[model samples]
Target: MRILICHNRYRQRGGENLIVDSEKAMLSERGVEVIEYVRDNNEIDGYGLVKKAMLYFTTTWSKEAEREIRELCRKYKPDVAHFHNTLPLISPSAYYACKEERVTIVQTLHNYRFLCPGALLLREGGICEECIEGDFRPALRHRCYRASYIQTRAVVRMLKKHRQMGTYEKMIDLYIALTEFVRTKFIEGGIPPEKIVVKPNFLRNPPDPKYGGDYAVYVGRLSPEKGVDVLLNAWKKIKRFQLKVVGDGPQRAQLESMRVENVEFVGAVPQEDVYSFILGARFVLFPSVWYETFGTVMIEAFACGKPVVASNLGSMAEIVKDKETGFLFTAGDPDDLAARVKLLIDDPTLAIELGRNARAEFDAKYTAEKSYERLMGIYASVIREKETV
Candidate 1:
């Protein structure tokens, strides 16, 4: 089948970007014709004041993107249009183009942008559902986006405009939620339950299960929302085990300044290296403060036959089964995290059992083959429904 993929990349590279790239590659590898239309958030940096102000209304609903997508639909006649991200660029306008062209539209909800202005559903280092519960004024008051009132107001306006226009309700055909927890939130925020499907991200080259494991690892962006500080603090309290951190972001300087003897920062490594690190690690630490739509790192750890010690809230709790495949700790609590990590460290036999179950879980649900099959089913179902209408 011919597919057209669209994404608006973040200023800094992230999981969404990686997922988009991986999906495209997987499709091509499977002999499906794939076309890509991409835009970057970096474009906003070069815009003038007037242009920036005008973006609030049109940013998430661009006529130019609509026109371009319409032309692509006519030229390529793709069977499905799979969109990863379209925030601050590409916009919800592309969905209208697909709707007009009678093309199947499949959108992957990588974050909570449609329901919350901050996208993370986070504020003051915790989960905040003000926008989901009501209007986005609380986001404006708190300066949620980039901690800038103007930027936050702009995002809020964009969300409010699309919502009023019924863009999400009318334009989107299928919503590919990363987890059941995220699907619940989207439904609570007014998205139709029947239209939403759960499809977690899959790794292209996952690690093979090993007999023994080495150090405990943390691999993700080093940001306040990721709870890197909590991971570091937790490691400081526990002296028996070693913790290796991968990836770098805004919190690097702060993480570097603190002297922790047991923790070592390896910085950001390539995708292959990350998988290798996961294979070598005894367990992966995922101490996120926000309500993550899906913890890709946790899945990666599972794919590598390594169990995870993740936050008890959000998708992490759903993904990592406590005492089964892995363990869960209270979000933002260093003491809880340390205790769980110590449990795994102290019990090698239990860790081995968890690792074995983790690999089995990955084989059953989190493989690229499984993802492709599920995606094809969703596309076919959407297409058939649209044809009937």
Candidate 2:
């Protein structure tokens, strides 16, 4: 089978970029032909003033992307076009190109960009779904995108234009939501219930499970949405073991200023080193306040057989089974987070049991082989349905 994988790479690489690369590699390893058409956001830096202004219109509908995608479809005769991201670069115009080519379209809901201008459904350090109600006015009024009304307006225009054009509802044959929570949110935002499928990100090369370690770890960006401040507060309450933060972000300076005791800010580490940190942790902490599309680190922790202490909201709540694979604390509540951490610290054997359960969970759902089977099944179903139509 042949697939056309399209992605608009972010300026600062993240988990979504990694997932796209991994999936492409996964398909290639299975002897499938994978044609990639990737564009990077970094290209915007070279744009002139006139071109920068034109970006607003192009972001809504990129004629260049459409023509290129159409040419690729004609050349490759791909069975399906799987899109990972299309904002500010590729644009939703590529979907129209796929529709015109009569190819099955599969879009992965990497983030909430389709439903919210901020693309996080987050505002002011909390979950905000005002835009999900089919009104972009709230986002514009608050300047949710980059805290600039003009930038927010551009994003709102793109979302509104595509939403009205029936691009999401009609052009795309299937939507790949990273989690059940994400699937439900898209359904609520008016995508057909039958069109969306749940597929979590998988770890292609998971390390062997480790039972116990010296410290607990947190392995994501240190931004406000990640609830890193809440984590520091939570750590302050626990004096038994050390806390190691293994990533860096916008809030690094402020977070370091707090100087919370027993917490080590290891900054951003290499991917392999990050896994090594998880393997050496008794448990992992995920205190994200926003509704994450999918917490890749949660699965990474599970793969290492280290239970997580995550916020009890959104994908974190759904992925980590409280008292089973890991424990869930009240979202944005430092006390609750501290208490959950204390549970594992007070009972090392309980942590071991939970970690073992986490490893089992990863084996059952988050492995690369399992993800391939699910993806292939989805592709086959979509292709058959399109052929019948």
The top-ranked prediction according to TM-score is 2
Estimate, for each residue in 1-389, the C-alpha lDDT of model 2 and write its tens digit: 99999999998778999999999999999999999999999999999999999988999999999999999999999999999999889999999998898889999999999889999999998789998967999999999998999889999999998888888899999999999999999999999999999999999999999987789999998888999999998888997699999999999999999988888889888888988999999999999999999989999999999999999999988899999999999999999999999989988999999999999999999999999999999999999998888
Off by over 4 Å in 1: 45-54
- Number of clashes found in candidate 1: 0
Query: Candidate 2 overall Cα lDDT vs. reference?
Result: 0.93
Q: What is the C-alpha lDDT of each candidate?
A: 0.88, 0.93
Model 2 spans > 4 angstroms off: none
Clashing pairs in 1: none
lDDT of 1 by residue, 179-273 (tens): 99999999999999998999888988786787347689999999999999998889888877788899999989999898787788999998778
Superposed Cα deviation of residue 303, candidate 1 (Å): 1.5
Q: What is candidate 1's CA lDDT for residue 125?
A: 86
Report how far residue 51 has shifted in candidate 1, in Å: 4.3
RMSD of each: 1.6, 0.8
